[model samples]
Target: MKISIITVCYNSDATLEKTILSVGGQTYKNIEHIIVDGLSSDNTVKIIQKHQDKIAHWISEPDKGLYDAMNKGIEMATGDIVGILNSDDTFFSKAVLSEIALFHTKNTIDASVGNIIQHKADGKVVRAYSSKYWKPEKLKIGFMPPHPSIFFRRTLFNTLGFYELGFIIGADYELITRFFLKANISWKYSGITTTAMLVGGLSSSGSSSYQLITTEIQKALTMNGLYFSPFKIKMRFAWKIIGFLKK
Candidate 1:
């Protein structure tokens, strides 16, 4: 099956090359690389032009934001399966795509996800966030598969629609909840490493991370028809605090 991998970027010249090389080095040959750049002022456009021949389709134009760029990439995608890899992230290994293809061929799954390792800006591995084996109860407590580690059949979008542009920080979380929890799609856990993500990503760290988490959990519960009492909301906030402490 052909896979279309989308990389969204802004002023990311410093880290874009790593993501480019990672996608270019994939063992699966029937793969298409699509890039949507937000008209960066840095050398990001130059870097993209340097590797233009290897990339299938790319556009360096101003966009609304991250989710808008991703939506554009989804529209441009022509592969049987679709996945997104952020500019600051890379595949865990060259065989990652090949393994994904093999897994899809063996099982009938609408989506497949794996583990992700968070790395520092200096290229230091911080911690590994492993996805829980898929379960409805776990999802109620704010469990979700990392977006970078997920590969889903493109038809999922045709059925359920793309990420909601309304969400700035929690759209991915909302999308995953809609697909896995609400729709009850056939998804599989690869139980293997998939992507290495930078630690300081929007939803991973910093002051805004708390807001993102709370919004995501609230949205997830609401969308799934699960009512969260005041106590439950506080419990979820406490969990976020514990997670930040561990980080």
Candidate 2:
């Protein structure tokens, strides 16, 4: 099966090349790398041009935000399975996509989810997130699989819906809630380490980032008609601490 990897960026010059090379090095060959740049002022566009041969499709233009750029890439995707790879992230191994393809081919599922390592820009490990504990019911308590580690069938976007542009930090959470909880899409955990995610992305920075995401998560749950409590949302921090302790 062909897989389309969408990478959305803004001023990502320093790390974009590593992201590009990761896709190029994937053992899975039937892959298309699409880039949506938000009119970066840095050398991000120049880096894209330098490795144009490795990129299948790319555009540099003003966008609403991260989710908007992702929507553009999803609309441009032509593969059967689609995934988002942030500019600061890279595949955990050359065989990451290969493993995803193998697992999906063997199972009848809408999405294939995996694990991820959250690390520093210098490559020091912060924590590893696994999809093993995730369930649709956990949405109420703000549990979600690592976004970068999920490879979804492209049809989910058409059948269910796209990311809610209304959200600033919780579109991913909202989308997952919409799909897994409301729509009840079938999914499986592949137990593969899919991506090495950089810390300090939209949802992973600091206490302020946590507050923003918690608020957004509650908003997402409410929008989906799911039961949520501010107290339960705070409880997710305990789970996060457990995740860190696991490392």
Candidate 3:
């Protein structure tokens, strides 16, 4: 199956080249690389244009925000499978897409996901978040596959729709909740490393981290057709603390 990998960027000249080269160097030949730039003031568009020959489709224009650019890329994607690789992240290896293709072909999976290595700016390993074996109920407690490590059938969008633009920070989590909890799509865990995300991302860098997690939990519950219970939310926070302590 052909895979469409979309990278969204804005003023990411410093690290965008690495992301582009990583995808261009992939062993998988049946992949399309689409870059959506947000009219960057820096040399981001120039950098993307420099490799335009290898890029399947690219556009540099003003967008509402990150998710808006992502939605634009989704509209331009023409593949059986779709994935996203942010400007600050890279595939784990040259064979990453090849491995994903093989796993999906053998298992007939609608979605494939694996682990993610969170790295500091200096490239030091900060932590590894292993997606728990997929379970609908576990999601209530803030369990989700790393967004960048997920590759799923493109048709899912035709049915479930794109990321909710209303959510600024927790849209990806809400999208996953809708897919796994509401639609009940069959997803497989690859048990392999998929992507390395640079630290200081949206959720980890700012004082908004706390608000993001809280909003994520609320959105997850709402999307799953569940009502939020103050007690349950407190318990979820408590469970997170326990997990952090164990680590």
Candidate 4:
């Protein structure tokens, strides 16, 4: 099956090239790469043009934010399966796409979820997140499949609709929980380390980022018809701490 890999960025010149190369170097040739830039002032556009042949479709213009640009990529995609690999992230290896394709053929998966390695500046993994532990009930406690590592059937978006534009930073947390619990979608974990994300991005940087994300996770859970006490969110935090220790 053809897969559409979308990369959304804004002034991401430093890491965008590697992200492009990761997709272009994939072993699977049927994949399409769609890039959506938010009117970057830097040389990001020039870099994209430099590798224009590898890109199937791209746009550089004004947009809302990360999630908004992602939504635009979703709208432009024309493949059987859709996956997002942010400008700051890359596929773990050239075989990543081939593995995802195999997961779809061998399993009844509407969405293929994988793992992500969030690394520090020196390339040491800070936390390794795998979808093997994710469950529908975990949504209430703030667990989600790593956003960049999951691939959805393009038709899933047609049925579930786009990301909520109202949320600027934390909409993805909501989208993940909504897909698993409220919509009752079919999904499975490939257990493959699909993407490697660097440290100090929107959700990974700063001291208060975790608090802000947890708040948004609670917000998404509430909006998706699953409300839990403050204790439930705390339990989620506890789980994450255990995961961090194990890693």
TM-scores for all predictions? 0.91, 0.96, 0.93, 0.94
Candidate 2 lDDT score at position 240: 72
**Could you list the CA RMSD of all candidates, in the order they appear?**
2.8, 1.7, 1.9, 1.7
Q: Candidate order by TM-score, highest to lowest? A: 2, 4, 3, 1
Which regions in candidate 1 have their CA more than 4 angstroms from the true location?
A: 237-247
The TM-score measured for candidate 3 stands at 0.93
Model 1 lDDT on a 0 to 1 scale: 0.84
Best by TM-score: 2
Q: How many pairs of residues collide in each model?
A: 0, 0, 0, 0
Q: Which residue pairs clash within candidate 4?
A: none
User: So what's the TM-score on candidate 1?
Assistant: 0.91
Off by over 4 Å in 3: 228-237, 244-247
lDDT of 4: 0.86
Candidate 3 residue-wise lDDT, 141-198, digit = tens: 6666788888979988888888878877778888888888788889888886889999
Clashes of 1: 0
Leading candidate by lDDT: 2
CA shift of 79, model 3, Å: 1.3
Q: Please give the TM-score that candidate 4 achieves against the real structure.
A: 0.94
lDDT of 4 at 68: 86
